[model samples]
Target: MTRTRKAMVLGAAALVSALTLAGCSPAAQNDDSSNATTYTQDEIDKALSTPTELTFWTWVPDVQKEVDLFEAKYPNIKVTVVNTTGGTQQYPKLRAAIKAGEGAPDVAQIEYQYLSSFRQTGSLSDLTQFGADEHKSDYVDWIWNQVADDKGVWAVPQDSGPMGNLYRTDIWAAAGLEGPPSTWDEFAEQAAEIRSKTDSYIADLPGNDPGQMMGLFWQAGAKPFSYDGDKTVSINLNSPEATKVVAFWQDLIQKDLVATDPDFADEWYQGLARGKYASWQVAAWGPLFLQGTAKDTSGLWNAAKLPQWNAGEDVSGNWGGSTDAVLAGSDNQIAAYELAKFINTDEESALLLANDQFLFPTTTATLKNPDFVDQESEFYGGQKVNEFFAGVSTTVDKDFQWLPFMDFVYSSYNETVGAAISDKADMVSALDDWQNAVQEYATQQGFTVQ
Candidate 1:
């Protein structure tokens, strides 16, 4: 069946009254009668005694294995797994379920990009009372902060899409470059050399992707938006840092050293597989897409740290990733928290890495484990890819924050800014239009846009 149909079917089966409990903490399930306000153990036992079931929604392929394990350990608790389709479709379903008030999943996987929006809508449960306090020591401070608000926590840290550069060794070798470039200047020099020495392009720059520009801007410490708990501030896209990033990309295109692909289509995928482009900027989960789309280039690919800015330190940034959150309305909040905690912590992280090659857990302890260091990936020339990623994860900046109107900002920015890159519009004009559009869109969404 189609992915959407599967999601609908699972959502239907898991929406029954007994399974309709909203958000609570994993600790709530273990509480005694004395702490009944927080869902004491007696209440959970009574609820479970009657064969309580929970619905879980996720898009990650690795989560299925964990669900199977969770089921085996708790045979009495039934779980229905729903795999949501595109982000555009998934959010509406969640919104509808929240509105209906009785059919939402006990837990749902949400992207970091949407955390602020979800929290604003009051769809998630406060996890602070669920015992996240004690376990907070186990996670990275930045990750914990990602899901927490002034009131309480919304979700447990799952995986991180720590950014890196994936390159084709063969392509670099053919271009007479010794290795991947380490700094922005070096990268530009090498790209020019590669174009001059060979027929292949250095990389595929999707002109329509503001996210790519955002990553570059982030490397220079520019944030699209900032929050002061009560108000949001917009960073000017015409700022020097943003201009530098856009200028560099424009030069690359003008020099004809990079291919200006509109999006990740068959042509782009095939080009990567055939070594037409030497490298691409990606995050931890990107390997999965490469594995599925470029099966033929198994051992040719390898990953390295992204090139540093001319004046910045050589640190990595994050791209895209999802986190798991318990619903405020879930009846089995305690049980759900337990599952969320286990999956996000060190032990389950190692298991996830071993089982699915793509997941890079955010827990520092998991990264330090021998299993993480020793594991080898055949797809990456038998490299201990996880170990390298683990070493880099610690240095990733946690200060990078997401805004409530990120979806609207990114969608509009990409389309407009992308037009400039494609030579369809003037850069200044495009950016001005983008900024105005974002302000208007955010205002419509009830956000105080500047």
Candidate 2:
């Protein structure tokens, strides 16, 4: 899970300011190429060497260790790290600053889902002009796409949250099961067995969790959303592929094989510690979190890739992660880009991000490094937790996209799909409600919906 629940942004005042700043977004996307004014290596070198200060806003604690590496390489550059009170409140402040034409950081932390919301307000820079493309091969392909498009590279991927299954091995043994199920059909069978044998439910699904739902849909190859770097969007929440996934969850929930519990809450923590849930359909960050909350259950746990729609497939989706993006309006674009790139690509700095900040690694070097991935976790019965997740990162689909008004898309899920799940209503038909709500909102926001 992310630091915050992708916290409430686009509040009333922020929304009004965003409206005031309308047309600054996609309509002017042509500025991407027009502003792609080439820069020589010497220019970038000079910019980094010159005395400059870059303000960076992020909530990652002790990120200064990584930033220090950047400053050491370019002694002339100093960076000020500001805590934006976490991701939930960060975007509103970011929007307000952009509206005032001041106080915005040179480099800022932005989540993949909210990147387009910022793009919709023309708040992010086209990092393509800063040679961001040169490092394209360094990051996982799917995550790289989240920050780059045909128009420009918006950010350098710092980390990712590939989905996986963290289960109680002892619980499986109690149910006479070998291990995690390889397919959805097998998962249901195991869920039933696990329930009959113990007090534990198979897993907990949060009715309020849009991130988890979106990730699962992504794994199933549901193209529910797309944007054209402009006002045009395609919203297809009711697609058959996505509906099938939801329908399966609906079946499990109604059958009492799964518990509809509010996750990341005190009760959920208790559930894990008390062995009330047999497994957690969690992201890469989850095992570590479980280690913290379920410390007593350490030796009893193991993790695996998410159960595939097909028996033999290895596929997953992402839930939480963030990136460093330069502001489009910052005068120090060159220096800012250098700072962003160094913090993520430099092996030492990047590893510090994973090891210290507890952010998952996105760079291929860190993902492959034995030192990073091969650490056996006693908490996981000596499983190489990072290695398992790093493998899951490779299986993530490369083509998932987000709608610009993701805040609404998420909130709408709470009203329609989430509500339906909580009510134990028809999950497949809830997609129709979700689709209609999204399309209606998209049209109202002046988007050309497809």
Candidate 3:
């Protein structure tokens, strides 16, 4: 999930067109350097003690606080922080650097969905070979799974977004509801009640957000997209499970229980401020965002688990989160991997990432710590929103996957399913159109779409 502060989309053309490569030979493509994978304790010590300089590219603000911890622990290694534009902008520039054989950072922040794309270029180092796999037990299962595949572990889990329901407690109270809905049936019933009684929508289903739509599909256990970081892939946007999800939302939109509004815009912000919408199905990162965007609604909200699909089951889908990956061409793989791991896993760094930078925690140590989860939010009616979301984190499905070409997938989704959503058309048929467009694009991209 892209935080409100970061760019939500990446454009490949921006990367290609922005480059002014100087004196680079056409043969200088995909610089797969001879970086070592494993290191002895002595080797690590020697590496850290050496006069080394490393570059890190990330979009997180105030990230220097975390970087300083690493530098303090290993004084000889100095890290240069670069605010590489996130989403489409970050990856293309990274790829350009690898092709140019220079100016690439030793470590780069990568979203889970885009990691496969970098892996496809063979430009990310396999962290598994450097003792990274041992930390698999340290992270949340879904997050650890995101950075690994059949090939190897490519990155360290930084932060994650396990989806949850955030609602206006006063609106629910006005509707004679005491807590969040336990099922979609209850949710819809409450939607009708909230609208009828209070003139407020249950939520806004943004027509432009494929990530949100995909997260819902993921929650339903629909494996709609998959790629091998190579030639083989799968697309099942029209699967029975996915159809069930699409149809559910279609019914809601048609009934006028929810609003059709694109998010991250002034109108959307105003909706939150004016209480036009009563609830948001958002990632853990959303509470801090909502506090800043909807200050007038402070203390009127509460957090809870997303409504269950099955009567008594618990499950969730992730909307946004990212990792720190060491590039394959880094001359200092030992230092790079250590830096990525340290910032994410070290207690001081991880806490600072959560408390200071507002990144939702991925490490179990940080996720469950009373220091992180025990605090009540003034904006959420004194609810321990972090604790609520931490509980939701445990229920996330561990098997969600993404296409390597998610940039295209999301763009295409906005054009097809999103358009239908906005126009109040037949979403079931729109799903078919989305399926066809994605399948055709996958085939055109030379993938063996299954």
Candidate 4:
């Protein structure tokens, strides 16, 4: 799940500040030749050798280990690491700094959903100018598209969270199930059996996680939100595809086959330990998180593909992951880009990010490396968790897109659709409320709602 930062409902004053700051930043004047800018090996070496200090903003703990590798390679370059909090707290501060034309970091951690939001401000530097395209084939396609577009490459893919199912084998066995469900119809039958025989709910569908719910929509090929990278966007949250997804969950919830609980809380954590949840319909990060939070469950669990809407279709979506992006206002673009690229692509740094930090691998080299993916996890009965997730990552759709106002989009879900889930009310009506609320917000933000 995308971590929610604590903040009161953003008022109109804050929205106005953001809108004004977005408009005030200078637009990049790009020529055809500018888009094709590339650095030769000698030129890159020269730039890395020059004395420079790059300020990087991120919340990943102990990322200094990766930065140190970059510094070791380019002894003349020093990076100042700053944890300006994450998404919610960081965006306002970054916007203020950009408006003041001072104090913004040279590089920052930006999640895929928010890339377009930052791009709207005209603040992110085009990384294609720094030769980012040269490494395009190194990353997973969905992740590469998150940071690059027809306009420019915005950042390098650092990590990703492809959706999958992590379930308890023991629970399914007790329910007389032979294997994981391949289709949603089979999943519903298993959910009913598990609840009746094993006394365990199939999963905890969070009452508040729009990102997770949206990931399911994505897996079903619902193009609910689309942005044109300009002022025009298409918002269709209540589409037929979206309704089918919601209705299926509504049936399960109403039948008591699934638990409606807030995730990432102590209660949810305890649910895993106590065997209250039979499975978690979560992202690639869920396996590692489960190992850390519910160590007692050790050998009882296993990984599988998400239950398909169409029996044989292989498809999934992302929930949480981020990239390191350089700002347009940075005077040290070349040095900053080098620092961003080094930590994610260099063998030593990439391995550290995967094994040490437990961020899912994005680079194909790291994904294929046996040392990275074949290692046994004691928590999952020596299962090669990374290998399973790496295989699942290949099923993610490459064409999914996001609206620029994801912050608002998510918060609105918690207020409207999430509220409905908690009340066990009509979810179809809730979807309509969500659609209207999003459309109104987009229009208010000066976006031409399509």
Most lDDT-accurate candidate: 2
lDDT of 1 at 342: 56
Q: For each candidate in the order shown, give its overall lDDT on alpha carbons.
A: 0.71, 0.87, 0.86, 0.86
User: Across residues 1-450, which tens digit of lDDT does each residue of candidate 4 receive?
Assistant: 001111112233355556668896332333333334554567677878889989999988799999999898899999999987678788888889989999999999888888888888888888866667778899988888878888789887888999999899988899899988898899899899999998799998888889899889988888898888889999999999899999999999999889988988889899988899999988988888888888988898998899999978999988888899998888787899988999999998999999998889899999998889989887776888899899989899888788888889999999888988887778889999999999999999999998
Put down candidate 1 lDDT per residue, 1-450, tens digits, no spaces: 233443454454355323546432233322232221344456455555556588888777656677767667667777788888545667778878988898888888887767777777777867765557656767666566677755677788777777788888887898898999888789899999889888788887786666666666666666666544345545466667667767676778877878887657878888877878888887776766786878888988898988888545777767666678888778787777766665666376445754474666766677677866687878889877778776666656667666766777777877788877676345656776877787777667666656
Question: Comparing 2 and 4 by lDDT, which wins?
Answer: 2
Superior by lDDT: candidate 1 or candidate 2: 2
TM-score of 1: 0.84
Tens digit of per-residue lDDT, candidate 2, span 325-376: 9999898899998888889989888888887777899999999988789899
Model 1, runs deviating above 4 Å: 1-50, 228-236, 346-350
Model 3 C-alpha lDDT per residue in residues 1-450, reported as the tens digit of each score:
212212211232234334524332342222322132344567677888898999999999879889999999999999999987576678888889999999999999999988988888888999865778878889888888899877789999888889988899998999888788999888888889998999799999999999888888889999998888788999999999999988988999999988989999999999988999999999999999999999988889888888888889999999988999999899998899899999999998999899888899999999988889999998887888888888999989999888888888899888888998899889899999999998998899888988
Q: TM-scores across all candidates?
A: 0.84, 0.91, 0.91, 0.91
Measured by C-alpha RMSD in angstroms, how accurate is candidate 4? 9.8
Steric clashes per prediction: 14, 0, 3, 1
Residue 445, model 3, lDDT = 83
* lDDT for predicted candidate 4 compared with the true structure: 0.86
RMSD of each candidate relative to the true structure: 9.1, 9.3, 9.5, 9.8
